[model samples]
Target: MTMTMTMTIAGACPGFRARLLLGGALLAGSALAGPAVAQDMPAPQKDAAPGLTKVASFEHQVTGVTVSKDGRIFVNFPRWTEDTAVSVAELKDGTLTPFPDAEWNGWRNAKKDQVDARNHWVCVQSVVADPKGNLWVLDPAAPAMAAVVKDGPKLVEIDLKTNKPARTIAFDETVAPQVSYLNDVRFSPDGKTAYLTDSGASGALVVVDLDSGKARRLLDGDPTTMPDKSVTVSYDGKPLRRPDGRGVEFAADGLALSPDGKTLYWQAIKGKTLYSLPTDALTGWLTSAVVPSALTDKSLSGKVETVGENGPADGLIISRHDGRMYVTAPEENAVKVRDLTAKGGTPTVLVQDPRLRWPDTFAEAPDGTILFTTSHIQDSAFYKPDAPAALPTELWSIKPGAAEATGSTTAPK
Candidate 1:
C-alpha cells in the first residue's frame, strides 16, 4: 500500500479564519514577541545562571544546534511557517552563512524523484556533528509539517575537512512513512549506527546502519514512543494550543545514547516520562525477523525501561563524564539534571532561566560548554495567527562545571 499527505498554509486550510479568531481571543493578553521592539527583544525571563550568554540570533525559528570539535557552530531552521531562505547555516563572526553553499540550502517545492533534492535541504529538522568531525543533516522533506514528497527524506553527511557533502543516505517509506516526522537523532560511539525519533503520525525509533545505508523503524506505536493524551502542556500559565484548538502533541522527540553506547534514552514531547533500552535490543531486532506483534509485546523480556521524568521535556543529553542526563523542561523554564546511576532520585535543576522560552536542543562543546537553541514554538504562527511578529530565535551557551568528556559528538536529541 502507498499513501501521500500534505498540509496547506494557515489561510488556505478550511475554517482557518474561524480558528484564528478563536485562538486570538483566548491568547488576548499573552506576550509572545514583547513590545514589537526594533532591537533584540528583552529576555522573557532572566537566566538564573550567571554565565549564560547569547551566541547568535536568527529571524527564523531554529530548533537544532550543534558544535564541531573545533568549536564551529551550526544551526537548522525547519520550514514550518514561511519558507526559509536558508534552512541550514554556519555561524561565523556573528553572521550565518548558508552551509556548504546556497544551492544546497535552496528547496522550494516538493518534487517526485528529484535528484537535486538530495543536494537541497527540505525542512531540515536537525543538524548534528559526529565524532569524526562530520556534520549530518536530517531532512524529513515534510514542508509545513505535511506529507513528504517521494524520495525526499534523507540524511546528508558533510566532511568538515572539505566542506562538501561526503554522502547521502536516502530513506524509503518503510523507514520514514508518509506521516513520519523525523525529529532528533543520536549516533553510536563508533559512528556506525544512528538512532532517530519519529515524533509525527507514527512514533518509533529509527535505527540506521550507516555502513550499508539501511534504515529500520523499530518499536512502532509502542507505549513508550506514543504520547500520553492525558498530559496537557501549559506555557505561561495557559494551555498551549493551536489555532484549531488542539494542544501540542508531539511523540518520541528527544533521543540520547550512553557514553559506552550501551543504552539509548528517548521521550515524547507531550509526555512526562522518559525511557531507555539496551542498544543491543534494537540492533539485535534489526537482524531478526521478529513480527510487529512480537516486537511490541511487553512479555518479550529485555525490552525498554521507563525512567520517569519531571514534566514535558524537549531535548535530552547524557553527560559523558558523570553519566548525568540533562533534560530541558520547558514548562519550568529550566534544565533538569538526573543521575542515571541513582535509583529513583529526584532530578535537580541544572539551570533555571526565565529567558528559555522553549529550550529545544543541546550541544556540548569540546571545552565543556553546553550550547542550546530556543525556538518558542508554542508562540509560532501555526498556533497563534495573531502572534506578534516573529522574534529572533536565540542560541545560548553555559558551562555546567564539568570537564570535557568523551562520547558521540552529535547535537541535542
Candidate 2:
C-alpha cells in the first residue's frame, strides 16, 4: 500500500508500511448502499460543533468536496491506501452516483493492464465546481500514491449541464513528475487559469492555462511550497507520527484564491507558514511567449509574500460571503478563518468538534453553508492495520457566521 496521505497511528512495527495520504469525502449512504438514507452510513458525530450537520457518509475514504452553483455536491477519493471502487461521485437524493459515468472511474489497480489509465480516473485527488458552471477534476493518476502512471496525470473539465467531459488537458512528466502528487486546485474567476498544490515527495505550484492547455511549475524546491522542517503536525498536544518515526510531511497541500482572483494562498501540510503571490505575476509570464522555466521560477519566487502562519492544514477556501479565507485545522479537529483585509490577519478559531476527524476539504453551498469532509487520517487503515480498507468518512457543513449558534442536522437531501 502507498502511504501518500491520511489516517491512523501505526507505531513503528515490523511489517509492510505504505503512504499516509490525505483526502476527505461525504454523503448520506454507504458506498455499497443504493439510494441510501442517513441510516446507511455512520450515525451523527457526537459533540460536533453547533450548527454542524452531517450530510453524507461514505464507506470509502474521501478527500475533496465541491458544490456547483446550482447545489450539486461532488467529491473525490484518492487511491492512497486502498484501491477505492469509485474515484469520483455526485450526491443526489442521498445517493452517491459515479460522476460523469462508471466508465471514467472504471480503472482499477488489479486490472491496470486491462484498462487505459490515461482515459480513466486512476486516482482522482480533487474536484471543483467552477463559477462558469463546469466541473473540473484533478487526477494525480498515481495509484497508491506511488509511481506516476505514464500519460495518466491530467485535468478534465465536464459540462455540468450536459454532464459530459468538455475538455481534457493532459500533464506530462515535466509538469507532473513521478515524485509529484498534485493535491488540490483552484481556478481564476473566469476559468482561464488554474492553480494546484503538489503534496508529494517534492512540493511546487502548477499553473495551467485552460484556453491554451499549457501548464508550468512555479516555486519548485522553494521553502514556501516545500514542508517546513520546524513545524510538527500535532494532535492532543503531541506530534502526529507513524510508529516508524515518520511524521506528516505533505507539502503545498492546502490552497485558496481571493474572491477578486488576484491573490493565491497555499501552504505545506508539513509546514505552517502561509504564503501568497499576485495572480497577475503568476499568469502573466505563462501568457508571455517562451520564457525560460528558470527565469520564470526565479521571478515568481521573488514575488512570493509571507501571508501568515497556520498550523499544518489540509483544505483551504476563501468564503464568498465574508471575503475571508477558511482553513481546515486537522490537528485540532477544527476550522479557522483569517481576514485578508487585515494588515497582518491572525486566524481565529471558527469551530471545533471531536467529530471533525482530520477535516479535509471545503465548499460553499448555494445557500451560504460551508461544507467539508472528515478524512479521519489518524484512524484509517493506512496507520491502523485492523482498520477496514473502506474507511468510514462523512461530509459536514455549518452556516458561515460568527453569531450563528445553532443549525440543522436532519440529513440534507
Candidate topping lDDT: 2
TM-score result, candidate 1: 0.82
Cα deviation of 25, candidate 1, in Å: 47
Lowest-sum lDDT 10-residue window in model 2 = 7-16
Query: Per-candidate TM vs. native?
Result: 0.82, 0.85
lDDT of 2 at 266: 95
Q: What shift in Å separates residue 217 of candidate 1 from its native position after superposition?
A: 0.3
lDDT of 1 by residue, 84-126 (tens): 6677877543345678776787676534423366668889999
Residue 170's C-alpha lDDT in candidate 1?
Answer: 96
Best by TM-score: 2
Model 1: CA > 4 A from native = 1-48, 109-115, 289-302, 388-391, 402-413
Q: List the residue pairs that clash in candidate 1.
A: 5-147, 45-355
> Model 1 residue 138 lDDT?
92
